[model samples]
Target chain A: MRRLHHWPLDPASRAARFALAEKGLDVDLEEARPWLRAEPLFRLNPAGGLPVLEDNGATIAEIGPVLEYLEDAYPGQPLMPRGAVERAEVRRLIGWFDVKYNGEVNAYLLHEKLEKRAQSLGAPDPQAIRDGRDHLRWHLDYLAGLLDERDGLAGPRFTLADIIGAAHLSCADYLGDLPFDEFPAVKTWYSRIKCRPAFRGLLADRLPGLPPAKHYDDLDF
Target chain B: MRRLHHWPLDPASRAARFALAEKGLDVDLEEARPWLRAEPLFRLNPAGGLPVLEDNGATIAEIGPVLEYLEDAYPGQPLMPRGAVERAEVRRLIGWFDVKYNGEVNAYLLHEKLEKRAQSLGAPDPQAIRDGRDHLRWHLDYLAGLLDERDGLAGPRFTLADIIGAAHLSCADYLGDLPFDEFPAVKTWYSRIKCRPAFRGLLADRLPGLPPAKHYDDLDF
Candidate 1:
């Protein structure tokens, strides 16, 4: 069994959890308080980032690596496609969500509305929030376009790209930041992802001091 | 043969170039004035980002995917490692550079100092630049620590992690933004990367308005 140090509220963390569930690997979920600069966690990851996994004793910090490790180390359900080109496409989408989406959406909302100590770093700039919203809208449209072409972001099969995309949206959804009504295709895709057995743990997540939106846990919503 | 729409001075563009070089793939580089919102290119990528690659009529936008596509399509020297765990680590570092480094360093210096159009989007926030510099110093230190343990970022092999890290730093180096004196290990590692044949194209890059530092081209520097 692996030990995962993560925060249920964090999209990247949830993505890692989702990957683990897909692999059918049971992991001990230890909710991490990253801002406090927790001792062992800090030592494990000097960057003090989340979704740190302790397998045996070696700790994997970044979400990309953690997912790759799971898919590679325990290849059961085939989360990623076998073809090199297909794998590249999958990795590309994963990177898109992890980097581009995180920058344009998650970081702004998570730091602004969620973290109490964000003011110390710098008061959440309204322009950044506005910019984030605009960027997300464009990204959602891009996802819709991609979905229109293929069953999933990468191809016909559900892969890490879907997991990453859903994870970011779920975080936004928790804060009521997602405008699902604007993106019907994306909304329907989210609904499909929400119904997955792997997503049960994520939907059940309840972050302290930050309650999810009304439709966050509602499968039918 | 793939076609790359790129700006010589762009770090992301340089990264894509380096990835292609590593794969020994011949990519026809088309210098694009993205800011001008050029026809066809702008229409293909409405985001107006750089290093967009066109291969077999399919347009691939974004550095992460471009690199992955190259590796998948042309597996010469293996820019990424063989094992899934190793590949994940490489991808993780790539993300670190593309996102964390981009946020903490490139977004500040490249957009502010080089582009100068950032103020039009939002007044050039001095605090953000200061924050970026501080964050980059910490990241450099972290990179040095990582280099202290291994030959390359992931392990002994020279992976895409090295290429991505070097790509960003090379851009900063060109602008004389990096304080190499502070992190000797990073400086030494960079020196090693600078000697690579693949890096020659990056060294030869010249932006229209932004001139490279005096030491930019001197490999001995």
Candidate 2:
């Protein structure tokens, strides 16, 4: 059986988990406290990060590769499109959300609200949060614009990009940071994703001290 | 003809350019000042980032997708490997450098040394620079370890991972930020990359007010 080392709350880890679920492949999930720098985990990933996958005798770290690996190894549900150009578009959106959204929005919120150390440096600066909020508005608008034309961010069908994007937004939603009403299209899209069986596991995720938002588990929210 | 909107000194832009050259594709390069956020470039990428590509009526932005597009559309030299598993490894390393390296090292260095506003915020905090230096040392060590086992980062043959990795390191090298001597293996790998014909254009990159390191153009330091 494939074993996945991940943290339930982490967007990247959730992305990997979502992909696995979408493909209908079962994985032995191993929750890892990445920030703690666990011994075997740290040794496996010199960078000491989460979302590592040990599959078929190969140890894969990084969300991008894990998605691609799943798509390649198990090609039934088709997480990515067949055409090269279409694949590129899907991959591009994934990169945009994974890198840009993570950098601008998710990281800021996670550091400020979830991680106390960042607060020790200073209280959660309203200005930084405000900036992140504004930036996320634009990103959500972009997603809405894309969803305006296509079923998914990339194209006509659901792909890894959607899973990854929703995973990040779900994390933000857990913190009560996502303004879903501001983006009606994105909100509707989220509703569809929330109804998926794969997302059921995510809704059950609960962090010790940091409780989720009221609407986080609401399917109709 | 393919057209590329980029800033010569930008590592992401250079990575796209390197991939294009490696594939023997001709691109009409346009110099874009990302900081200015010009209207034309903004239309191409609402984020107003560098390295946007226009090819055959389709516009693609972001380094990872651009590389994937090229590898797919023009498969002559094959910037990526044939096997699905090997390709996964390559993409993972590319993400490591582009996302992880960019977040921890390049972003700090660029914000401190290049962006005047960030520098003016404090006094180019010595501690931040020191932290970046230390972080880069570990990154170099990690790269050295990877190089120790394989001929290249991903596999036997040079892939897009190698090109992108060199692109980031080259940007740091220009600012004299990389300590090549600490990791002999990485230094050797870098020297090999420097000698490539595709790297010639990048070697000539010059940023205003930030001059290249004395040995920037030298194949051997």
Candidate 3:
């Protein structure tokens, strides 16, 4: 029995879900709120991180390890390229989204828009939101540039890089923050990936009282 | 014909150096200041991150990919375990140090202590430093607890987890932080890893105006 503990809107958790679905692995999804730091979550992962994968008796926590575990243990559908250079490039994109994008955009945007509601941390700071948007523009431009030349973010084939990029961008789109029209290349690229079977689970997500944007799930938007 | 572009004190850079040396891959170390956002650095890695490795004709950037590339290209003296479970465990620790530890401790400690000096930012915030120290203590306690059962961080074998932990801790120690005396087990573990030939290059690193702690490089401190 394989089970994945994740939050619906969490980028890392979303990435795990996309990867699992792409690999054709059947998994029981358990929603874990990372901000809560619940006891069960801690028991599974000492660090209290979301997107933990439990395969039979073995436990794999955090996005990095979970993704790697799937690739190693499953290996049915490869998420990474075989060549060392190509693999390194894919990993670089993973780092870019996981670290750079998260720090620059999500830390402020998600924290204010999403986490603040969960934690009852009061109103969002406009300045911080503006800063996040500004940074997001820069990131989008970079992505647009990459998509202009390649079929996917890393290379020709759709890899984990696409999953991670979409995971993050989907979250931002949910908040109606992503200016997709401005970066048509990225928008076109996303449209192709968004149409995949793996993305269905993400589009169905609704955060109760906090509804997503009108075009959040619309494939044609 | 291989060269590694790195900043001496950066934990990720230090980890790359340790891994390269451990793999017995001779690399020409070229120090690149991340803060400068140098044109050449950006040309190699669009992300402008430090510790970019140029191996002959190929360019690999960031610690995560760099380490993976090394493991893939050079399999001897493996930094990761063979089993999927063990490899996941090692990666979890890497994320722990890279993301968790870096955010909780280095964001404040290194920023105030190191980056402030580099960027000509004003005096260090006492509160931030205190918070970093408090977080560091908690992390140290966790490490001590882990060491009580296992010989190394991931298991009995010395993996990249040890290298990453030492890299971050060594930076803190250089800044005259890291209360090694408080956590005897962590201290003992550091003592063992610090004596290795891979660590010698890191120990010898010295910034022009800034000298390390009194026992920063001392093997038996």
Candidate achieving the largest TM-score: 3
TM-score of each: 0.85, 0.88, 0.94
Local accuracy of candidate 3 as per-residue lDDT tens digits, A1-221: 99999988899999999999999998999988878888999999998988899997999998888888888998888988899899999989988988899999999899889999889999999999999999999999999888888999999898989999999999999999999999999999989888999899899999999999999999988
DockQ of each: 0.43, 0.60, 0.81
Q: Candidate 2 residues B77-130, lDDT tens each? A: 988887768988898888888778988888777667766442356557667788
Docking class of 3: high
TM-scores, chain A, per candidate: 0.92, 0.94, 0.97
Top candidate by DockQ: 3
- Fnat, model 1, is 0.56
Lowest summed lDDT window (length 10), candidate 2 chain A: A114-123
Backbone clashes, each candidate: 0, 0, 0
Question: Model 1: how far is A55 from its true place, Å?
Answer: 1.9
Q: What residue runs in model 3 are displaced by over 4 Å at the alpha carbon?
A: A125-127
Sort candidate 2 into its docking category. medium
Interface RMSD of 3: 1.0
* Full ranking by TM-score: 3, 2, 1
lDDT of each: 0.81, 0.85, 0.92
Provide the fnat value for model 2, as a fraction from 0 to 1.
Answer: 0.69
Which candidate ranks first by lDDT, i.e. highest?
3
